[model samples]
Target: MSKVFAKRLFDGESWLTNQQVTLSGNVIESIMTVEVPSADAQSVDVLAPGFIDVHVNGGGGALFNHTPTLAALQRMVEVHAQYGTVAMMPTLISDDYEIMSQAHQTVCQALTENMGGILGLHYEGPYLNPVRKGVHNESKLRKPTEGKLADLLDVCRLSKLMVTLAPEQVPEDFIEWLTAEGAIVCIGHSAATYDQARQAVESGAKGFTHLFNAMTPLVSREPGVVGAALQTDKPTWCGLIADGHHVHPATMRVAIAAKGCEHMLLVTDAIQSVGSDEKEMAFLGKKVLRSNGRVTTEDGTLAGSDLDMATAVRNTVSLIGRTEAEALQMASLRPAEFLGIDKEFGRIKVGYRGSLVALTDDFFVEATWIDGQKVWG
Candidate 1:
């Protein structure tokens, strides 16, 4: 068994002290919180579950929009690993049907070769409200036609397909249909009214993608998509970008108050610009202007985020008024649970996968492991 020891550890719920965890292959075989490190253990600091980012556009100067080759996948995965992101769903923005199809094939190929970190494909566009589409090219937005989506996922042979659609545009029945096919339907890039958004949720829209940004706002009479997403009784996981830019600090508080931390998943929603020190770059077929850790266009619409998974953890904690343990949950265990992957990925408990990250006191991931294998930088 391979073992890791940490001075502090997050056990998926709360912070604990003096953790010594042993793993064999992918599963954690044993866990003990004791004073001394195990004889067979490699010691680290603040060991936590490896982060699971449900939305990542690109990293390491490569983007899914530009070219989604397997090599590009490897690059992003490596860069994200440095920040403790272990498993991630490669996100592709709204694009032509042909480009999306190729992305699906890319996911299938990644899966076939045991590219373990590639969870699935996230289609963030093509069925969205053009009125609320942010960086998504409005020209490529399409109405949901009968069987078009199923055909796309099938062609790509994708097991998990997360689609973010504007409830204002797509029919309610499509939400039911997509959910029935095991495709996670998320509401995002939308101008969906309250009733429309609620109907989508009722029809099996399980999540809200990058909530509060590019979505309808809460109103007195209208309530809007943001309002619908904040309803706690609803079983939807509200995905937050948490960059301190996409949603304001006060608004972030409201989201946390409305939806409990468990009901929220933190995602970078990062485009190709994340993790790159490169000053000049082109993204989404246009120039990306970056200054002081902010990535945006000259017009000031957020292109994506320079914030990686680790920084996301820090930023979320600052906004939520919660402990580091709680914020980390949004980045790790909670997201894994939202994806129904908690059994294997979210914790350092027995029988769980050894997807762990060692973070500094400031929450920077120093090293990452997927299963028991180190994802070296």
Candidate 2:
């Protein structure tokens, strides 16, 4: 058994000081609060649930969409681990069928090996709308047919799968089928009206991907995808890039007010430059440069991002004026809930996995532990 104490502990919902957490193997054994701090407890300024990222395309100078290999996946996990990301759904963006098949096999191998930090795989496109495609390759985009959907579903039974598509391009029943098969269907890259987006929600589309960008803007009358996202009464979730470039501070505040932290998530949408010193990388056969804290192609098309999860949590606290506890939830618990894996991964409570992050008072990641093993500092 191991024990850790924190000056302040955010126990999923609220903060408490002078708390000790006991762990056995890879699971938390118990949590206790002490009036006086323990002198020998391994302690830090703040103890938080490890960050969970659902939209990471790449890290450690590697892009999953470019090279779908076990080595690439390990490098990406190691890179993000330094930023307090203990679990992530490595994302593969729009690509050809051959690439997608290769990625599926690679993800299966990684999961079979019980590789640390590889939660699942997020297939972000190929079923997207061309109108709001953003950086996704238009040539590879297509509507989902039964055959294509079956091929994709075949991978989900082996691991958790999240497929982001355009609601306007897919049939309602297909969304239902995907969800029934244990795939989280997310809406993105579309020009769907409010009604179409709402229909998707009713049809089992559980979340919105990279919420304002690449989605139809919410207008006063039209009320596009953004409107549907903000106004949905269901326990629907929306992921924000939160790099301060994809969204403004004021707009992020508005989103928080409307959806609140429970229905919202913070995603990195990170590209290949996260842990590398490289100033540029390739995406979809185009070169993307990182400058001014933004990643964009030569034509100024916003690609993924250069942001990491730890920096994203800091931006959420400072840029949107949210409390540290709330920001940490946005990075960890909320995303875990959205992925329907909170029971196993998100909280620091008894029986939860010992995937935890220790942060400085200033929000810098001092250290990260995954499954009771210290992986990064």
Q: Pick the candidate with the highest lDDT.
A: 2
For model 2, which pairs clash?
none
Candidate 2 TM-score, C-alpha based:
0.96
Cα lDDT tens digits for candidate 2, 1-377: 66788999887888989899877888888899976656666888999899999999998888998889998999998999999999999999998888888888888888888888988889898889999999988999987767755775655777689999998898768889889998999999988988999999889888999989999987779989998899747879999988889988899899889888888898999998898888887877999988988999999999999899999999988889998888899999999999888997778888898999999999898888888887887
Off by over 4 Å in 1: 155-158
Model 1 poorest 10 in a row by lDDT? 150-159
**Candidate 1 global Cα RMSD:** 1.7
What's each prediction's TM-score? 0.96, 0.96
Q: How accurate is candidate 1 locally (lDDT)?
A: 0.83
RMSD of each: 1.7, 1.6
Give one digit per residue, the lDDT tens place, for model 1 in 1-377.
67888899888877888888887887788889788786877788789989999999999889897897898899889888888899999999998877887888888888877786888888998888889988777788989776656667652344567888887787757888877777888999888789888999888888998888888899889899989999987788988887777788788887787788888888998766777778768877778888877788778778877878888888877765777877888988888877778888788789888888988888777778887788752
The whole-model lDDT of each prediction reads 0.83, 0.88
Cα lDDT for residue 81, candidate 2: 90
